[model samples]
Target: MSAPTATAPVGQTDTDASAPRRPRRKLLFIGIVVAVLLAGAASYVLVLGPDAAADEAVPVVEEGAVIEVGTLTTNLAGTPAQYARVGVALVLSADADQSEVTARFPLVKDAAIAEIGRHAAASLQGEEGLEPLRRGLTERIQAVYPDGEVVRIALTELLVQ
Candidate 1:
């Protein structure tokens, strides 16, 4: 008869069985660590995002205001016939100081005169044309002074030959 096979100790079986589970335990530990890190990153972004944005924002100016200029005369249709005469009054706005309006007067004048000449001659065709010219002039004036608004463009006098 053969000798009885050697038997492992009873408690040693449990140790042998647990050996294969070690890799799974390590993976679970890594997953938990990753999850914790992600949570911490999310919390940090949520808490400090607005503060960081605020730091980059520009400051507000409270004392800013606007100024308007009255009527100015300029040659129409690039001619001095004295027949195609037009008058334009601009209502412009400025910051707290009126210098901004004064400084931009030349630009304003050129733009207004050119626009009026272009629209006025055609607009003299009929009463309906006059409304369109008024609207066009107002819009043109506003475009010239985008930062400073044009409240109105009063056609004090419009004559075209």
Candidate 2:
């Protein structure tokens, strides 16, 4: 009655069987997670290379000549008369001679006008249309300026009515 004797509780054990193994299991799980993370990072580097985002940038051509096609007024391909007035500027190759480009303005303008006329009014509405239009314009302009190809065709102004 004065003091309780040293004895184990009814449902409790003196030593826990899983006490040491719990910490070890936690550590093993942590190690496995770290290993997986490291593997993922390694695979990403291997697949995409070190500078993944850097690889996606477009290259700028230095000393590029620009030729203005002026404002092109044309009717779109439809039953109703829908016209488009687009001001285009052609960025010629870096190797292009400014003098030659000036001389070949007629050819360049003609090609660009023809290219613009090829598209329907609805097809040139969104961002999706810009790429195809650019590609087509480049192809058209490059035909005449084969030596100094058109690197880029920029739409300085666009209007459809």
Local accuracy of candidate 2 as per-residue lDDT tens digits, 1-161: 67976666787565753356678899999999999999999999999998987877856666477778788888777744887888888887878777777787788788877887888888888889777888888788778777755677788888988
List residue ranges in candidate 1 displaced over 4 A: 1-83, 93-97, 120-122, 125-127
Relative to the true structure, candidate 1 reaches a TM of 0.42
Write the residue-wise lDDT of candidate 1 on 136-160 in tens digits.
7778766766764555566666667
Cα error of candidate 2 at position 21, Å: 37
- Cα deviation at 40, candidate 2, in Å, is 13
Model 2 scores a C-alpha lDDT of 0.80
Worst 10 residues of 1 by lDDT: 60-69
**How do all models score by TM-score?**
0.42, 0.60
